[model samples]
Target: MSLQALWNQFLADPGRILNDLALFFTLAGAWLLLATRRREQRATARLVPQNEAQAVALDESTARMNRFFYRFGYGCLMLALLVSWYSTRL
Candidate 1:
């Protein structure tokens, strides 16, 4: 199909495009969250604490990163849901 025809098709029903985009982001966010968690866990396991202070700092940083990832992943999911809902209503 020609580029113009593809564009016209999308323009006729833009909801499909939004829904697909939301689905893609939803999956990507979830995968990123899981992968980060696993990687951090492995790194933490291999770490040899040279001092108590350093270990505490590392733990704090890891906690902060974990919280950030959780929030980011959930935010993406919520946004995707909102987009999906809107698309359905369109």
Candidate 2:
């Protein structure tokens, strides 16, 4: 197909374009939030003394948060992929 025909075909489905944009924004937001949380944790960890129980607790919490973030982030990605696939098939 010609470039013009491809452009026309893309424009014919405004919904797919919008869904892709929304998914992009969602992934971006998730990444930003994860980065911010990691930075905050690092700063906070520096303030706590190495010998304290609180430091240990903080380390555990950080690990848990990291794991949760990865799991949740991947779930969102899978959902976005499903949505994109479904949109294209519609």
Candidate 3:
């Protein structure tokens, strides 16, 4: 079937939509958190030799980014959970 046809079929089932959205947001948030953590770790590990100062600066930046991503991820998960709960009540 065409993409539009498939989308229409998918939307015809509200339960599927809710479940898919919940799964999507959860997975996306988890992936973002993992990626941010990995980047922060790599930046921290680079603090050696002549680049120690620069590495420290980069590590701090990465840490900030990691914190932002972690917070964002948590917010997304919380919002998604709230939405799912609200949907169930309706």
Highest TM-score: give the candidate number.
1
All candidates: TM-score: 0.70, 0.49, 0.65
lDDT of 2 at 57: 44
State the lDDT of candidate 2 residue by residue for 1-90, as single tens digits. 999886787789866775876588568658956885787678567766655565444457766876676777767667677767667776
Give the residue spans of candidate 2 off by over 4 A.
1-14, 25-58
Please give, for residues 9-86, the per-residue lDDT of candidate 1 as tens digits.
789998998899789879978887898789777766667454535552346777788788888988888888998898
Off by over 4 Å in 3: 1-12, 48-60
lDDT of 1: 0.81
- Which candidate leads in lDDT? 1
Residue 55, candidate 3: C-alpha displacement in angstroms: 12
CA lDDT scores, all candidates in order = 0.81, 0.69, 0.74
lDDT of 3 at 3: 96
Error of 2 at 59 (Å): 1.9
With a 3 Å backbone cut-off (N, CA, C), the pairs that clash in candidate 1 are none
* Candidate number that wins on TM-score, 1 or 2: 1
